[model samples]
Target: MGKEFIELFEQWADHYDETVTGHDLEYKEVFRHYEAILAEVAKRTFGHVIEFGPGTGNLTEELLKRGRTVTAFEPSPAMRNLAQEKIGNRAEIKEGDFLSFEFKKSVQSIVSSYAFHHLTDKEKAEAIAAYGNILESGGKIVFADTMYESVEAYKQAIKDASEKGFHNLAEDLEREYYTTIPILKEMLEANHFTVSFEKMNDFVWIMEALKK
Candidate 1:
């Protein structure tokens, strides 16, 4: 499933900006909310930031604007190319999966938006462990992604999509793996992260955890 999503994203890379720009008003609002979160993270950790799953450099550009050194990682080749074009020498864009990517150096912060939920539950747990291993002490991990109110809510979302003629579209879209805030908090805490969350509207949630 991860490989399939990578392929789909590669095909969508060329038209990603156009397809997303103002196409979904709700999603656009989500991005704006994400930008605000990025600003806060930038002010708190202004050096040596690493961003995972920077599909097309949207948030990467924002981090660079704040004068932070950014390492942007995206798995899809086409998406990485587009990000490199947009960011140029200001940012280092690399092609690698966040779940498996390694860095020789530690970073002051790691940020991801609308991307981490694609990982399986085990993968998500592993990612938190990886972040713990790579992050400098007192560094932060800020992430925004889909969060379900309950297990039933997730099931309803799946049912709603199927009934609205979106089953196929949803299937083709990135598969989301969601967990409640408590579950996420437990995972982060187990990994030695102090976690907090802010619900941004109904569809998205922003979580910030500082390494202790």
Candidate 2:
């Protein structure tokens, strides 16, 4: 699962909002158009939704605004607390990760933002497979996160970040499980999902996968 990064998220909980708002220079490009990205994901989601790594609940808020019922999971206690405080009782925010969660209701969509990179490629595939089992035909998975077009692009990103004196960003790019689009496309298709992607920023892309 993605719970391995829970400690980082716990320490980042308080300042996560600030980072997404472009206040952090190193991550500014990574979180560019943050609000718009959330809105776009929310717009594409429908009916009962399962949201992974809700973080501070920014996307959850967007989904609620659109009248979508949301069931969210977060591995970090600090992040989960902030999300609950921000969202109140409107949606349930549980202690879970992408590969470990419980849901009984019929879910029409799954949504997440800036959080999936914590899982390695194999784990990502596992999570998608689980979603494939959980959702019916026509169910959707909308996720906005940092993904590259190719392996070269991913390496160049780390290099570019380093040249820009963004050591932290470069290290994060190297440390995290950030992957390329082709691999994700293959995983989605293997799980019987027809997927499309749209660029959201220099470092972010929106993956909209529909169960087939």
Candidate 3:
């Protein structure tokens, strides 16, 4: 399922920007919010950072802007091209999926945005485990993604997307599986991550987990 989704993203990467205008604002805010989060996380750990599933280098650009070295792993070729064109010589962009990608050295920080919900429940659990394996002791992972405040809110998002002709939006809503703060905390905790969650907005949830 994860592989198939990665393939779909590869196919959609070229048209992704046009397909989702909301991503522009979401990406921008991700950077602004991430700065503070990264600072707090970095204060406790040190090493090269790896960003999983960086789409088009939005967060990568901001991470570089803050004077942090990052290795961005993106599975989509089109996204990698766009990120390379956007980032230039700023950061190392690797073309690969987060679930299976290997690292030569342990990283201090592992971050992701708006990509985790694309994974199945099983894959999400596996990815969290993999992150634990790759992160050095005391390292952190900060992730931001959609979380439903209520089932009604999830329904409304689907309805809104339906009105916009994106009938498949419901599939993107992972509320049925892992959309609430508790679920996210439980998953991270099960993987030996000390979790803290902040509700950023009606739909977005920011999670910071330190390996303990």
Candidate 4:
């Protein structure tokens, strides 16, 4: 488990969603925006599902309504509690980090939102490989997250953040980082995932990588 992340997210559990959307002006709609895409995926995908980080169970709520049995790996106890309260026994909750958590059974797809970027490039690769390992053939990873164009773009965003009165947020964004889509594509491809997109833009993306 990532001790640092555990503490950080626990502290942020209450305002996590607001914090993310509020600070990233352009992506405030990402949460609501991803519903339709994931809904489309649930219709097309099959078997059991797993979600990496299910903050307030917003997406989890949608998944349950669509009849997909979901298991969520959310490390923050507070967030997990919030999700538990939000969705009850509708979905299984695993209070652990994705990297440390074990996949007990094979699943059809692994889904996530705004969570993968928490990992470094190497860890992202490892997590992708883990998803591949647990999924049955044809099973995939469907996720939406911040995908920057370059290191410079993220750096510049920091300046823009300060100019917008988000000094603390700018500092935080400065700490957060990402790997470009091309690089993420190569990593997924190398791990035997054929990548596709449900949504694509300069800063964020909703992607599907089918395991081969």
Better of 2 and 4 by lDDT: 2
With a 3 Å backbone cut-off (N, CA, C), the pairs that clash in candidate 3 are none
Q: List the candidate 4 regions with Cα displacement exceeding 4 Å.
A: 17-45, 198-202
What is the RMSD of candidate 4?
2.8
TM-score: the better of candidates 1 and 3: 1
Every candidate's CA RMSD: 2.7, 0.8, 4.3, 2.8
lDDT per residue (tens digit) for residues 87-148 in model 3: 99988788777676868788888887667776766778788898898888898988777766
Per-residue error for 188 in candidate 3, Å, reads 1.0
Clashes of 4: 0
Which 10 consecutive residues of model 2 have the lowest summed lDDT?
A: 1-10
Clashes of each: 0, 0, 0, 0
- Residue 75 of model 3, lDDT score: 79
Model 3: weakest 10-residue lDDT segment is 25-34
The deviation in Å at residue 65 for candidate 4 is: 1.2
Provide the overall lDDT of each model, using Cα atoms, as 2-decimal numbers.
0.76, 0.93, 0.70, 0.74
Error of 4 at 184 (Å): 0.8
Segments of candidate 3 deviating more than 4 angstroms = 15-46, 149-156, 159-171, 174-178
- Candidate 4 residue-wise lDDT, 89-123, digit = tens: 88888877668786779999888877777787888
lDDT tens digits, residues 1-212, model 1? Answer: 15547877888798777645635442454444555665665565556998988888888888888888988778888988898899888988876776867588988899887777777777888889998998999989988777776777767766765666665434633355667777788889999999998777455677899999
